[model samples]
Target chain A: MKSFLQPEQWTMAAASHWLLVTTVLLSVMACSSVPAPVAELAAAEQAILTAEQARVNTYAASELAQARQKLQDARAAVVQKDMLQASRLAQQSKLDAELALARAGAAEALAVNDEMKKSTEILQQEMLRNQTGVKP
Target chain B: MNYLKRSAPTAVAAAMSLMLLGACASKPATPEGVINARQQLNKLQASADLAVLAPVAIRQADAAVQEAEKPTKDQALSDHLVFIADRKVNIAWAQAQDKHAQDQRKLLTDARDAARLDSRTREADLARSDASVARNDAERARDEAVAARTAAEQERMAAEQARSGAEQDRLAAEQARNAAALSQQEAESANAKAAALQAQIAALNAKTTERGLVVTLGDVLFDTAQSNLKASSSSHLANLAAFLKSYPERGVIIEGHSDSVGDEDYNFGLSQRRADSVQGYLLGQGIAASRITTAGKGESLPVAGNDNASGRQQNRRGEVIITDAVTASN
Candidate 1:
């Protein structure tokens, strides 16, 4: 039983070693051929930073969180030596951060518009009272 | 077994060298992006509005900061996490501010509605008060009109009373004036009657005495020593009868007288017969018999002495006396 097992084990070990070598060679080749997603990562980081300055974290919290998660996925892809996936994730993160900033501005403007509408209602009531000669 | 021992020592040496190289490459200093993200997170958490209105957002921002602070070999990935964390913190602060402004607008709207209701209630109260005043004024005017009518009625009654009194006074004055005029007319008529009676007595050659009116017939009115009246002297007796007829309220007295030439007894008889004759003649001429009385006077009541013819002539005569209603009683 030992003599039979030793041959099979040696064959298994040789196969594992060849697979390991092939995986390492493929990883090296992929790293050498693909460019780093440095520009896309920088754009995603700059967009999220601009959203923070514009108060998007509070007004568009869900969108800002989604942008942050996409940027993290992009960094993980870079570490895995998948430059195409990393660049795609970084671009998506930049667009998501820009959307979060626009949503924050839109929400703030909507709140302002609601307040202005209430003021106009009060002004109209005062004018009616004056026209009718009713004391206030 | 010999190949495994040799390979194991080689793997151990490689592992140790690899660990040393990793130690040299690792960054111990905190990244500037991570520090800025932490500061932003702390500012959001400290806000009073973020704790209540934006609690969920603040918690999300805190989680992002923690993720950003995690150690990583990739510098680009660490910077990206820090940027997202800062944006999350700003989102919490903006939500809190917007909510506060909305509450203020609601408060102003409520105040405006309350003021409008109060103004309408005041206007209704003023209208009710004015209506009450108008009703009172109308009632006063009606009362005044009633009072004026009562006063006019009283004045009319007073005027009626005054007119009745004046009419009574005028009737009394008219009655008194009529009585005075009647008395004056009666007095004047009585005076005229008295004057006409005096003229009739004068035409008979009568003299008024204390007793009545007296008329004398001379001796020539009769024949000498005769009892009969002559026709030429009958006119005097007729005129006397007419005066007696006109004055029916009078009575007459007859007297006879003679001269002394005759015997005493015979002369008395002749004087009596002569007086009777004159009275009988007056009665035949329409004088009431009850209005005459007769008497004779012989030598005892002669007007002259028998010595002279003129004296004897005057002594032979007949006389008549008429008595008024007042003198006849005596």
Candidate 2:
């Protein structure tokens, strides 16, 4: 409530406001001029590479294709200067690649489970038959 | 670097919202993609068995869902967040399921091992029992064989005993038959001897009486009054002597009788002399002297009345008595 403003304080405050304005303008310019989502894009590409390495393209081809498409779309967004969309699309691409890898792994795991189940069943049946055969 | 990129977008988005705030009076609902992502994440989180399996992935998925659920005016950004969230949730689930399946494989492996071990154990048990059964059968067979051998041995011994008993019985019967034959031969010989003795007695003209066989010699067998055996009686005396020789146990008693003539003492003396003459004749024929005896009866014991010459002649006789013939022949 007391009037504590002085001339030097006002001069310093105004100088600070100009600096702040300059900083805002610079940040706004940086935002509008779309820096490509280089890290996110690289992450997505890396995820795709990992999925391909895992042979996800063979088992989860559709998901892998979608991930590839999303990565391409992210590149297109970067070219179009839509930095936010490019980042989002890159993230989505990465997630899609991961999903493809996850799907492929799940499919192989389930198949292995089925194989084991069948093997166990065969063993059980053989045991039963052996037990029954003894009676004769 | 990524953080800076993201914050820059938020600032831009906030500015755009402020500009659009005048046109839109109310806030927008959460995007369908975000709702879908939230639903998927909720399902993943509800699974306790799956949630704990991939802790880092689940945490990432949770963060993605929360970011997607944040009310944002940017449709593209919301869609990207939703997709990332959905994929992350699905990835978490896939990873959890993979881990779960691998974990289950351990149990399955154990089960398979158990089954294999159990099968092996059963086979071993069966083989062992079979061996035991075979052993029992073999032992039983051995025991039966031993019992059979024992029975056979006992039967053989019994047969041997029976054969020996039969042989003993046959031998006894043969001995009895031999004894019977010997006795029969002795009896036949005795009967023949009795017949021969009877013939000898008849030849002697001996008479049987209570005393024994009696052979009487007429007075002519002696000299008129002298005591001497006449030669005419030699044949009859020889027969008697032969009988006495054949039966050595026979004892002779010679008695002399006379007619009522002369003095009694003189008559007795004459008879005694006549008995002595017969005994002397028997002794000459080889009769034992110990088996011969002589006695004389005077005219008082005459067999007929001495009033007639015939009666007197009948009374004047020497009698040879075989006293022990019946007893000695037995």
Candidate 3:
């Protein structure tokens, strides 16, 4: 809170202002060159939410956990201002979440197929028995 | 040289940036994950078994693969899309498998039902055929039994007829045998009578000659060519008469023969007188006149040669012959 209006303090303020402006300009240029991964992060979050909604915890628990970890990594990359790495991690998270959702869907389909197969087998055996005049 | 030295770091930084941008621009020709997703989608589309059953799933997988294969600046985004697409393809494949299995099971069930129905139909047909065969067999057996019974009845009737015929034949044969025996008895009785007659005739020294039963009175009985028979000859004539009377059906012939001792006419007259004398003696013994015949053989019918006295005496004879019934009737 000391007065910076003295001649020596004024020279120090001028050098500091020049350095701060250069740093701001460089930061602005870097921000313009590398955009934020806002869309990818949102997509990853939506995918993870969808995986959870689809009961991936039961069918693809490991994949869902990996997706959540990847999503956390993407957020850390965003905090570190690593736009490219953030984008990559968000994408990886989205992919993992999608994979988890797909695995859940596949598991559900496989379970249904197994049940159908069992029913079909029983039906076939019963039909065979009937045809052969054997007791069912 | 100083300018070169001053621009070296910038040049290197520019080159590195260029290389980085080049790497970013020149992406992998095809992402393996996306390619794999595309291949799985293609396979799902190609499946005909699941076309109708999982049409929606196949369409979704195809859409997801197309999305995944899209060129993007973010490789991770591409990978993520590819992963989702691959999973979608897997989901589509799973759905297709499930539906395909269900359809196969349905088809098997239908076939099994049809087979059961066919088996039942065949069994029913066999049963009907067996029933028809049984009926035919029963009918045939009944017919055979009826035919057998009829044959047995006919045989029994034939046997009865044969028995009656045999009985009749036996009675007829017995009657014939009885008649034969009666005839044989009659013949034996006749033979016995004939034998008795022959015995009586033998007592008179009678002999069976070609003419008939002949009782000869030698020249001794005629008394030296006299026409009259001697007393010894009367016994022979008496026996002949008695035989002739017993056999009324018989007749008698009185034959006289002489030796060649005189003229032929005188010998013939002597023979006739001797035959008439024998016939008169038989008539006196109660033999009917009709039952007697007389003949005279002159010296031509001499019984012996006239070379000596004994031969001439033997030739002079009076014979009484009993004729058969046939000759008598004639």
CA lDDT of every candidate:
0.73, 0.79, 0.75
Q: Of the pair 1 and 3, which is ahead by lDDT?
A: 3
Candidates 1 and 2 compared by TM-score, better number: 2
Per-residue lDDT over B12-97 for candidate 3, one digit per residue giving the tens place of the 0 to 100 score: 99999989988877754556678877877777677676666778877877887888877777776777677668767776776676
Candidate 1 lDDT tens digits, A3-91: 22234334554456335434544564665877666667667776776787788777789888988899888777766777777886887
Which residue segments of model 3 deviate by more than 4 Å?
A: A1-136, B1-32, B46-53, B66-84, B94-201, B207-214, B218-234, B245-250, B255-290, B295-318, B322-330
Q: What is each candidate's DockQ, to 2 decimals?
A: 0.05, 0.39, 0.08
Compare the candidates by DockQ and give the number of the best one.
2
lDDT winner between 1 and 2, please give it: 2
Runs of candidate 2 with Cα error greater than 4 angstroms are A1-136, B1-18, B21-44, B63-91, B94-162, B298-300, B323-330
In model 1, which runs have C-alpha deviations exceeding 4 angstroms? A1-136, B1-187, B261-269, B297-299, B326-330
Docking class of 2: acceptable
Q: Provide the lowest-lDDT 10-residue window in model 3 chain B.
A: B321-330
Q: Give a tens-digit lDDT track for model 2, residues B131-239.
A: 9999999999999999999999999999999999999989988988988998898888989988998888888888898867888888878766778877887876788
Separate clash counts for every candidate: 6, 0, 0
Residue B307 of model 3, lDDT score: 93
Candidate 3 CAPRI-style tier:
incorrect
Specify the highest-lDDT model's number: 2
